[model samples]
Target: MNAHPDTPPASLPLFLHDSVADAVALSAVDSLAPLLGIAVKEAEKVVLKANECAAGFTVREILCTNETREILRELVKLLASYAVTKTGMATCMTRTPTLDPDALRKRFDDVREGMRLHELLDGEQIAAVQELFAKAEIAPIRFDTTPVIATRRRGLESKLQERYGDYVRVAVVDSAATAQALLREAYPVLLVADADEIVLDEPGIISIPEHAVADDSIVYPEFVVQSFRAKSAAIAAFVQLVTEFDERKTSSLLDKISIPDLEAVLALLAELARDESAHKVNLADTVLSWEEAINQEARFIAQTGGGADDFKAYLDEAVISMADELQLAGEDRDLLLESAYENLERGPPFEFSRAHTIRLQEHYARRIAEQRYFRLRDYATRLIPYEEAVNTALKRLFYLDFLFAVARFSHEFGLTIPEISSDGLGVIKGRNLFLVDEELKGGETVVPISYSVGSTDLGIFGATPLPVAILTGANSGGKTCLLITLATSMILTELGLPVPAERAEIPLLPLYLYRRKMIKKTGSFEYSMRALSRIFMREGPKVVLIDELEALTEPGAMGRIMAALLNHLPASTRAVMITHLIHELRPHIDLKKIRVDGIESEGLDATGNFIVDRQPLFNHIGSSTPELVITKLMSRVRKAKLRAVYREILQALEKERDAWP
Candidate 1:
C-alpha cells in the first residue's frame, strides 16, 4: 500500500537534530530499540528523534489507536505466514537493449573493436587512458585505431586468427567474383560487405567502403582504451593471483560451483564502480568487457573448422577438468563450469571486415553519447517508482515493529491511552514510566499516586479548569516522582501512546518538562532562568512541569521570585510547579488563579517507616515533618519493642506539633 498523504512530516518542532539525541539519552529510550526487533539501522531510522518526530508521531498515532493497530497487527501476522520479510522486486525484464536491437548490436560491435584494441596497449598506457576519460567526463572508451600494421589483408587476418583462434575466423574474399566462389563452399561464407572496387549483389552481403588492405596501421581508439582500463587493473590483479597460486588451489577456486562466491565477486565489481575513488572510471566498462568477451568467444567457435558444434562442450570439460584437478567439489566445480559456458554465450554478431569495423566504430561513438544522456533520464524517472515501493514497504515494516513494541510496553506497565479532556489532567494511580522497570526488577512496588487539579465537566452555570498546581511535601516523599509521572504521561499522550496510569483524562498539548538536572552542571541559575524565559515567550498551548524551582536560591527569596515569574507566564500554558517554598509564597499567589495540593504522611507504618499516602489532597499545604526521620531510625533498632516505643512517642509528638503553615 502507498504511504498516506498525511504521513507526518520528518521535521521536528523543537530542538531539531540535537534535541532528540538528548531526550533519547537522558530518558533512556534506547533501551526500547532491542524490543522493536528491527535492524539497528532501521530502528535508528524510526526512533523518536527530533528530526523524525513528525513521522514518528504519525506512526505512533496509527499504532496507538486500537482499530488501526489491530489491522496492522493482522497484516504482520499474514506476512509471518509467508516465512519471508520481503519479496525481491524485478528491476528490468529484457536482457537486450531496447533502442533498436539491430542498431544496438552494430554499436556493440564497434565497442568490441575497441575492446580488441585494448589488448594491444601496455598496462601503463591503459591506466593513462582511464584517467583521461575520468577527467574529461567522457564515456570510458578508447576507440582510436592504429594504422594498419600489415600491407596484405591475409597477414593481419592470420595474426588475428592465431591470437584469438578459439573464436576468431578469417575470411579473405577479395572481390565480388571471389565472394561468389565462396558461396559454393560447404560452410556458409556470408558476404558481409560490398566495396566500391567489387560491388556484390548477393544475399547476406552487406556494403563496405574498401576491400584492399592499407599500408599504415590504424591507431587503437581512445574509447576502447578507457573502457578496458576500467577493468584492466582488476583483471590484471586476478591474473596475477592465478599465477601466484599452485595449479591445484587455483583449480579448486575456479572449478567449484560456488554461486555465492561468484556472486560476491560480481557484487564486489559493482561496488567498485560505485566507489568515490578514481578507479570508479571502470563503472560501465567492466560489464561491457564481460559481454564483449563472451561474444568474441562464441565467434571463435562459429568460424573455426572441425567440431564447431562440440567446441562449447569441449571448453566446459577443459575448465571443469582443471577445477577437478585442483580438488574442487560438487557445486563449486559446477559453478566454475557454468560460468565458463555462460561467458561464451554469443552476445552480438559482427563481421571483422576493416571498412565495416571502422564505420561501426563511428556509429558506436554516437550511440555512447546518446546512451549517456538517456541513462541520466532513466535514473531520474525510472528509479523513483522502485524507490517509493521499497520505502513504503520499509515504513510498513517499521509500523509493525512499533506495534509490537507498544504491545509489549503496554502489557509490562499496564498502560492505557487516556481519554482526551477539554480541561486540565486527572490521573488515577499514576506511576513514573522510567522507574517502572527498575522498580519491578528490585521487587519494590511502584507507589501510584492519584492526582487532579482541573475541572473535568462543563457546568450550566460555569466551570473553571485548574490551570496551575503547586505541590509541597516532605523530602524524599515522592513529590518529584509525581511531577515526572504527570509530565511523562503528557509526553506519551502527545506522541499518541499510552500512559502509566490506571485511568486519566488529559488535554493534548505541547509538553515542556524542566528539571534541575537537565541543566548542565556548568550552567548557573541565571542561565537556567534565561532558558526558561525564552520558552515562555513562545506562543502555544503547553503543559509545563517545573521540578524543585526552589533549587535556584534560598526558599524564602526563591518563593518571591517564583511568584513574580508566575505572573508573567502565558495563560495559554497549564503549569505544575513543585516547590519547597509553598508556605512563603502562599500570600503572593492569588488563590483564585492557582490550586494548592500536598502529599500527606501519617505518623508511621508497622515497620516504623514514614506512611506517605502517596495521594495528593486538595486545598492543603501538608506538613514536611522531621518526626518521620525519627521513626525511620527507630525501625533500624535491634529490639522490636524499642521501635514500637519510639513510634508511639513520635505519634504523640506529631499530635502536639500544632500544624505549621
Candidate 2:
C-alpha cells in the first residue's frame, strides 16, 4: 500500500538513522536484500512461520519494525525475483485455526494453491488433534495451543515422509529457533523491527481500524505503565543509585562514607544474583537513623515486659523525662514519642522498613496500643525542638526528600505541570527523523504516557546521528498529535537548542517493535516477551519502544507479565509502551498523558468512527520547523462527521491499491 498521506516528506534530513559504524541505515535495509534473495534460490518449498495478529484475510498494518513479517515478505519477494521453482509457502500466523478444516482450505487457496496462514499445524485427524492438544482457557488465550504445536509437527512429519515429494526441502522461519532445522538451511537469518503498535483489545486477534483520515490515523501513546507503588519503588531505587553514583563519581565527597571496596561491605553482591532469599543491606546512615530511633524504643519496651502490662505506663514516664531533659517543645516531642510508641507496638512501618522482625514482637504490639494516645498528647511532651529543623526545607518528599529545586525552577519559568482537571490535556510530539513510510514517518503510531501539566526530560532514542521516534496513542485521542508539528520540536532539539523546555535527557537505543499479531497477555509473559527478551539485552542508553504491550496478551496475564518485566529491569532503562489497555501498562512505565483536544466522552461514534475533537495544530510546537501543509490542514478540520467522511475516501483508495496487483 502507498505511504500514509500525513507521513513526513521523504526528503527531510532527520528521516535517517546514523549508527556509529555507518552514516545511514540504508545498508541495514540492503542487508535483508540478500536474505530475501536467498530464500528465492535454494528453497522452492517454504514453510514460513509468520506471527499473524489479524482476523481472516488481513495483513499487518504497522511498518519498519514489524520485522518478522516484513523480512518474510522481503524474503518471499526476493525469492520470487530470483525465479525459484514451484514455491509453496506456509505460515503459522493466521486469524483462524488450521484445525478449522474449511477455514484452513480457504486460507490455503487465498493467494496460491498452497499458501497457508500465519498460525497453523498439520497433523493427524483434526478431531483427535484438537482433543489431544487443547488446554482450555478463558478469553484472550488459546488454551489449546496444541494445534499450533501439532500443526508444525504434522507439517514437518509429512514433509519428512514425503521428502522430495513435498518439493524443495522446505525453508522454515519462525521465532522458535529450536525447530529451524525442520526447514531448508537450518540456520536462517533473523530480521526484526524494534517498534510497532501495542495491541488494544484482549485476544487482539481483531485488528484496529486505521485512522479516519490518512493524516490523522490513530496510534497509541506511552503512559507510565507501572503500578504506582512499583513505579515509585523503581524510581526511588534509581534516584538512590544515580544520586549515590554521582556522589562517588563526581563529588568524591562520598569518600568519607564509601567502603574500601564492595568486598569490605558485603561478601558477595555477585552471589546474590543466583540466590533468591539473600537479605540486602543498604548503605550506612540511610536507614540507620530510622532504625536507631526504633531500637531505642524497642529496648525500653522489652525491659518493661513481664505480663506487667501496666509497666507500659513507664514508657510514658520515660518519654516525659526525656522530653523534659531534652528541653523539647510539645509538638516536637510528641512526634518522637509517637514514633517510639509505634515502633514498640507495630515493630516497623512502610515509612522506614520494608518488613518486620520477630525478636521485637511484644514491643511492637504495645506500641500499636498506645500509638494514638501519644499522637493525642504529643503537644504535652516537651521534647527537643528538632523535627521542625529537619523537615522545614523541602516539600517534594515522596521519597522522603524535598525537591524545592525542581519546584523553584518550574515556578520561576511559569511552567505548570498539567493537572488532570485542566482544560488542555497534554502534549505528544516527535522532532525529526527519516521519511520512512506511512505507518512509520507519520505520527500515527505513538506510545504516549498519561502526563499531567508538565513536560518530561528524555534521552533521545533513535538511529544514531538522526532521530526517529514511534509513538502510539489511545484508540482516538492520540492520532493527530502523533506526528504533525510534534515532529517539529524534535527537529529543533536536533538543531541544538533546548527542545522548547528547560531540560532534556535524550539517550540512544536499539529500537525493537512489534505490530499486529494477537498477543495474548499470559501471566508468564508481558506483551512482546519474545521480542523484548531478544533485544532488551543491549547495554547502554537504549530505548525499548512498545506500542501496545497489554494488547499483546490476556488482560489478567498482561498485568502480571508487564509487572514481572518491570520488576526485572533496572530503573536506568528508558522505554515507551502505548496501548488502549492503559490499566495494564500503568503498572510499569511512567505516563506522558494527554487529553482529547476537544470532547473525549463519546468513544466510537455511531459509524464505528473515533469521535475525539481535534485541537488546533500545536502553536507551541518547539523549533524544528513543521511542514506548512501539515499545519494548515490540522486547523481546517472541524467536524468529526466530515473527517470520518474524508477517511472513507482514503480507505477506498487503500482498497484500490490492492487491485493494482
Candidate 3:
C-alpha cells in the first residue's frame, strides 16, 4: 500500500548498530545522524523512529522505497553545492497560537451591542472596534443608532435620548423619509433596516444591510470580525519563517520541492505574498503617536537654534513635506495648528518665539502619524483570512528540513538506492564506510567487494545461490569487513536510504551480527550456544552474520555444531559464519547443503607481505597459511639457530601440504 501523502517518511537510519560495529571490528565513532545536519527536534524524532523501525525489521513496500529514493535524488540534484550546514538549520520549531471561534464570536456580539447602546468601549473593546473598521476599509468615527418607529412614537425619542444622553443623538423617526431628512441635515445618519430595505447611496448615510440589523441597530457581520480577530501570535511567527526561507531559496530549489504538503505551503506563501503586495504598508514610516512625533521635532529644533532660515529649512524638510505626502485636509490642519499654539503658550518656554513653526510641525506630524497608522492597520487586517494557512506552512517547513537532511546524507556518502527483493541479498562494489579512510597496518586502501547470497537472479554467485555458507580466509583477509558491508547495505536498504554500494538488492529481514568474543571462562561455550539457539528459534526469516564463532569453543566441536546448525536452518533464512574450522566442518556437513566461501591469500610478494584478495571467492575453501607467517617472521630474525629451526619447520610443512585437502 502507498503511504498517505500527508505522512512524512521515517527518518533514514544512518548509524550502525553497536553489535554490527563490534562484529566487524569497527571503531566506536561511526554514527550518521550528526553528519546529516538535521536542525529541528521534529527531524530528530524522524531519525529516532527510523532506528526503531530498523531494529524491528519492519518491511515497507518496494513502491514506498522507490518513491522515497526519487525524492532524495531530486533534492540532491537541486541542492547541489548548496550546503544546509552553511546557514545551519537552526531550531525554528515554536509554539503556535490557537484561535477559539466561540470566544471570537462572543466578543463580536458584545462589542456590537456595546456600540449600539452608546456605551464607552473599554481599551480592549476599542482596539477590537478599530480593527473591524480597518478590515472594512473605513475610518472609525463616533455615531449613534436610532429606530424608525411607525406607531406609539410617544416617549420613544425621549427614552432613547435619556438612554444615550449627550454622548450621541438618538432621533426616533417614523419613516425612511425622516432618516433622509436627517442625512440631508449632514447628521451622518446610520440607517438600519429590518425586513424592509432602506438603501441610500449617500456619503453621510451609513446604509446597514437588511440582514445586518438586530433590534433596530446596525450590527456588523460576526464572521468577518472573527476572521480579523483570529490573526494570533502564530501567524506572525509563520510569516517570519516563510520570509527567511524565501530569501535563501533559489527558484531551482523551490521548483524541486514537489511534495504535496510542501507544495501547498509554497502556494499559500505565494497567496500571502500577493496579498501583501496588493496592500503594502511600511510600519517603520509611522511614529508610535503624535506626541512622539512632537517630541522628536522638539529635539531637532533644540539642536538647530531658532534662526529664521534654519526654522524655515526645518519646516520644509520635516513639516510641509510630510503634510503634502499625507494630504491632510485644510480644516484639520488649521484646527491642529490652533491646538498646538494654545498648548505651546500654556506649556514650557522655548529659547525664542518659534511657536508658529512648532505648531505647524506638530500639525503635520499628527496628520502623518494618523495616515501611517491606518495604513498599517489595514495591512494587518487584510492578512487575518490566512491565519490557518500560515500555521500549516510553518508546520510543513520542519518536514522539509528532514528531507533536506536525508538528501545531504545521500549525496555526502555517494550512496545508491537499492532494489528491494522478495528473497536473498546482494551487493556490487560495496565499500565499508567505516574503513574508507582508515589507516591499516598494511597501508592498503579499502577494496570494494561484490558478494551475493540466497538468490541466483543477482548473478554474482554461479547457477545456484547459497542460502547458508561458511566464510573462511587468511587471518586478516577482510572476512569481518565483508560481513559488515553486507549488514550496512541491508540496514540502509530497510530504512529506505541509499546503500554504500554501486548496486544492491536486499530483502527486508531482521539482522543479527554475532561478533567473536574471547571469553575463555568454563561456561562461555554453553553461553554462546544458548545465544545462537535463541536467534535461530525466533519465528521469522532473518539475515545472520557470525564472525569467528570458533573462538567460543574447541575447533572440532565448533565445526560440528556449525555444520549441524547450518543443516537445520529454515530454507528461507540466510546466514554467513566466519570460521577458521571450515576444513573440519567439511567432514561433518554435506557440501551441497552448505557452501564455503573464501578470502584467499596468494604467496608472499617481493615486499615479503602476503597478497590477499579481500573479496570472497564463492564455493572455495582457503588455507590460513601459517607457514607463510613463519617464513616472514624468520626473515625478521637475525639469530642463526632460530632461522635454521624455522627453515626445518617450513620444510616439514611443505611435505604435509601435499597431503592437505
Score every model by TM-score. Answer: 0.44, 0.22, 0.48
CA lDDT for candidate 2: 0.28
Candidate 3: list runs displaced more than 4 Å.
1-43, 50-417, 437-444, 461-464, 516-534, 553-557, 560-565, 583-590, 634-661
RMSD of each: 23.8, 35.6, 19.9
Candidate 1 Cα outliers beyond 4 Å, as residue runs:
1-391, 457-465, 519-523, 625-627, 630-661
How do the residues 1-661 of candidate 2 rate in per-residue lDDT, one tens digit apiece? 0132123223321211111011011111122122233332221121111112112222322111454334334423422221111110111111111222344333323322111210122333323222321211101111111001111223453432231121122333243443333212221111111225332221101222222111101110001010111122222322333343332233221122222222211222223223313322222242345456534664665677632244356556755665554344444455546644655554332133223222122223223222322321232122112212111110111111111122222233222221111111123333111111122435453233222112232322211121112232334444333332222222222111122222323321222344334344243344456566754454443333444555555786776665555444433443333444333434453222321111132234554444442322221111111122222333367888876765665555335322321
Clashes of 1: 38
TM-score of 2: 0.22
Error of 2 at 611 (Å): 3.2
Better structure of 1 and 3 per TM-score: 3
Backbone clashes, each candidate? 38, 107, 0
What is the per-residue lDDT of model 3 for residues 450-507, given as tens digits with 9 covering 90 to 100?
8888873557744247688788777878887888788767655544456778888887
The predicted structure with the larger lDDT, 2 or 3, is 3
The lDDT per prediction is 0.47, 0.28, 0.49
Order of candidates by lDDT, top first? 3, 1, 2
Q: lDDT tens digits, residues 233-338, model 1? A: 3333333323333431423222333323323433444544353243222313432444455456656766775344565565555555545443344543454455
lDDT of 1 at 322: 49
